[model samples]
Target: MAEIKVEKKKPIWPWIIAGLIVLVILYFLFANGDDDEMIDETEQEQVIDTTSIEEENTANWDNNRNDTVGGVDGYLSYIGDESRMGIDHEYTNNAIIYLMNAVQAKANELNVNIDADIEEIRQKAEKITQDPMATNHADKIKDAGSDLTNVIENLQEEQFPDLSQDVQEVKSAVQDIDGSVLTLEQKDKVNKFFDEAGDVLNKMS
Candidate 1:
């Protein structure tokens, strides 16, 4: 017998099956990693930023605080809100001083001298300013306000033709504001100053 060489063919099906199994395992691992990354991203997106909310709240508070004070104009401070008038002595004193100055200015404008009349009023204002929670603060303001209003009203009509009408209106304004509310500020204490005389002073040209 001649030498015979026999060749055995190896089946490739086992290798193919092994390759398919590896591919399936890799797919599952990668798919799980991608899902985990997506979950982390979703968690980050769901987080809320409170910094902007806090800033907005602070801004609103500042606005409310600013609204409480109308502001100081020249020699006058708005004296806070009307609700704090009677109890707020410092502001009340400031308002009285404003009225006193207004009266003197008006007299000067009309070429009249009221230095003597205003001296007493000035003293009262000084007292209110120095005293803490003065028991008679309201009374002092009322007296001073009335005195100044009368002085302004008594301007000689012959010399000041507007005394009977315009000045009279000013007097009425003062009387009306005595125990009432004024703009953004003033009340039982500084009502005459803000509601009455302050308005007039603002209108004075």
Candidate 2:
């Protein structure tokens, strides 16, 4: 019979040390990894927040400029309906609103970005009505601008003479505005409109 030898049990210290080492490695692997992930998550959130703010600012700027252009064009049409053809208030108001919106849409289509100040234009438009003594003058000035714009709208290069006198009158009145409500950009538009209208009117004449 082979003699069975009793094997001595190794000290528990080695096993305990091996287990502690495994735990420490796991803590660094998972716990420290999670901390790194948290930092990445924080960075991603900050980038998203900043993007949202920039988008909001751009939207606000677009809306403001759109409103400003619309208001100015509306005022122009309103006085035109009243002065040129004796259009009633309700029709004039509604038509002016539509025309103004149309102009804004066209500007957008052409990518003619303008940074018009809506509040400032509104204030000036309101002031046009406030001076009782000069109300008619203000109204006439607006009418002249609108008439010129209309003439340009209808111009066909072949018809310019019929509106020659009106074109001259519009130019004179446009120049007389104390400071002018239209922006420099708008003034440029006005000038182009006048040139086109004059060419048409001269041909017609």
Candidate 3:
């Protein structure tokens, strides 16, 4: 009898399973990469939208004009109905700018430099200049208000007392300045500052 040898076949299941696992891993890697790309694109779009909004605001500010100014109010004092005093309120918090503008305009008309007085007022109103809508600095607000009254009085008395008889009215108006919005009384007081001041401005014009 001749010796016979039988050869056994190797199992292919393990190799097939390994190949399927490799395919799954490749698929997941590509899918995650695609997801990251999409996220990046979305972020870029958001940034573009934000940039456009800021640009539109800048354009509006440059093109906007106010024409309803009456009496002593400067036509350029406010863009639209609000008294912006040519200030970009979005970037600035100068609460007393309106008052400052009133005085500056008068000083300019008289060919005088009241920079010292203005700086003194600014120093007294550090809280207001830093944040217009602040309400916490009671003493600071009071002191600044007092300084405003005194400044207006001195400016009027030294320059032309006949121009305005109600220079003291600013004290009441300044007391109500807890925020940017003004009450009727506040507006009237401010108008007093600008009323006769406007006459001087008109003469210069």
lDDT of each: 0.57, 0.44, 0.51
Candidate ranking under lDDT, highest first, comes to: 1, 3, 2
lDDT of 2 by residue, 133-179 (tens): 44243343355345434433333222344565665554554554433
Error of 2 at 49 (Å): 0.8
Name model 3 segments beyond 4 Å from true.
1-95, 129-135, 172-205
Evaluate model 2: give its lDDT: 0.44
Misplaced by over 4 Å in model 1 are 1-88, 156-160, 163-189, 202-204
Give TM per candidate.
0.47, 0.32, 0.45
Q: Give the TM-score comparing model 3 with the true structure, all chains together.
A: 0.45
Please write out the lDDT profile of model 3 over residues 99-205, one tens digit for every residue.
45555556666677767776776665544333444434444544555675666666676776664545444555455444434222244443443333333434333
lDDT of 1 by residue, 4-36 (tens): 899889999999999999999999999999999
Clash pairs of candidate 3? none
- After the best TM-score superposition of candidate 3, give how far the Cα of residue 4 lies from its true spot, in angstroms: 20
Candidate 1 achieves a global lDDT of 0.57
Worst 10 residues of 1 by lDDT: 63-72
